[model samples]
Target: MSLSYENYLALEKYIESFEDKRGSLIIILHKAQEIFGYIPEEVQEFIGECIDLPKEKISEIVNFYSFFSTEPKGKYEIMVCLGVKCKKKGGYAILKDLEQELQIKDGEVTKDGTFRLKSVNCLGACGSAPVVVIGSTLITEADTEKIKKILHEFEK
Candidate 1:
C-alpha cells in the first residue's frame, strides 16, 4: 500500500526530531514502521534523504533485523517457535497445520489479511516447548486442535 502524504510528512518530522541524536537510525526506522506499517523501498529512500545516509545502508539495517518488515503484516502475526525444544515437540507440524489452514506459507499473510504465519528460532519459553505467539498472547504446549480453536476466536 502507498503511504499517505500526511504519513510521509509525519515521518519527516519524526526524523528531524532525532537529527542530532547519535545512534538514532534504528529508532527512526522503528518509528517509520509504526507510521507506515512496513518500510517499503520508497520509505527507505525517504529516510535516507532525511538522514543523509545511503538507502543501501538503511536497507541493510532493515534486512538485518527480523523485526523490521518490508511488506504489510496481517492483523494477527502468528509466530511458531522453532527452537530446539519446540522443534522436537512438533513445532514443524504445527507450522504445517497453520499453513494448511491459512493457505499461506511462512512469512506470508492470508488473503483476508487476518493472519500471518512465521517460524522463529526461539521465544525464550523452552519450559513451554511448542509455543505459538499471536500478537502478545502466548499459547504454550500448543497443538493443532488448540491453535485451531484460538484462530476461530479471532475469526469471529
Candidate 2:
C-alpha cells in the first residue's frame, strides 16, 4: 500500500481527532476512504496499527457496512436500482444491459477505470422506476439506450 506522506499525515491527523480508539474507528475509516477512495487490505492494516487494533476488527467493520468498499471504485459509479419497485418495473434488464455494455459485473470497476457497475436496493425514487444513478445524476426509466446516452456524457 505505501501511502504517500501526505496521506499518512492526513491519517495521523484523523487519528488524533478522536481520543477513544473504539469509538473512532468508523470516523477514521470514513476519513481514510475520503483520502484513499476505497480501503484495501493494506490500508486496513495500517489503520489497525494506528488504532492498536487487529486487522480483523477493521475488516469486520468494513464488511458489515455497505458504505465501506474493499474494492476500488471508478471515477464514476453506475448504480442500477434493484429494489422491489424498480425490479418489478424492469430493473433486472437494465442492470444486465449495463453489465453487458460496461463489460463488467456488478460491483466491478471497468478495465479503463472510467466506470464501476453496481446494483442498489433503492435510490428513493421509485416513482421514476428503473433508475440508473451515474455519479450524482439520477436517470429515471433508464433503458439500455438511455443508459448509453447518460454514460456518454461522462466519458473521458
What total of clashing residue pairs does each candidate reach? 0, 0
lDDT of 2 at 124: 94
> With candidate 2 superimposed using the best TM-score fit, by how many Å does residue 148's alpha carbon deviate from the native?
0.8
How does residue 26 of candidate 1 score in lDDT?
Answer: 86
Any runs in candidate 1 off by more than 4 Å, and if so which? Answer: 1-6, 9-27, 64-67
lDDT of 1 at 133: 94
Question: Candidate 2 on 1-156: residue-level lDDT in tens?
Answer: 225778878888889778896688998998888888789998899899988999998999999999997988788999899999999998999988888988999989888878999998999999989888999998998788988987998994
1-156 per-residue lDDT for model 1 (tens digits) = 349999999988888787463379989999999998899999999998888888999999999999999998988999999999999999999999999989999999888878889999999999999999987789999999999999998888
TM-score quality measure for candidate 2: 0.73
Regions of model 2 farther than 4 Å from truth: 1-28, 63-66
Residue 87 lDDT in candidate 2: 97
Q: Each model's TM-score?
A: 0.73, 0.73
Q: How far off is model 2, as Cα RMSD?
A: 3.5
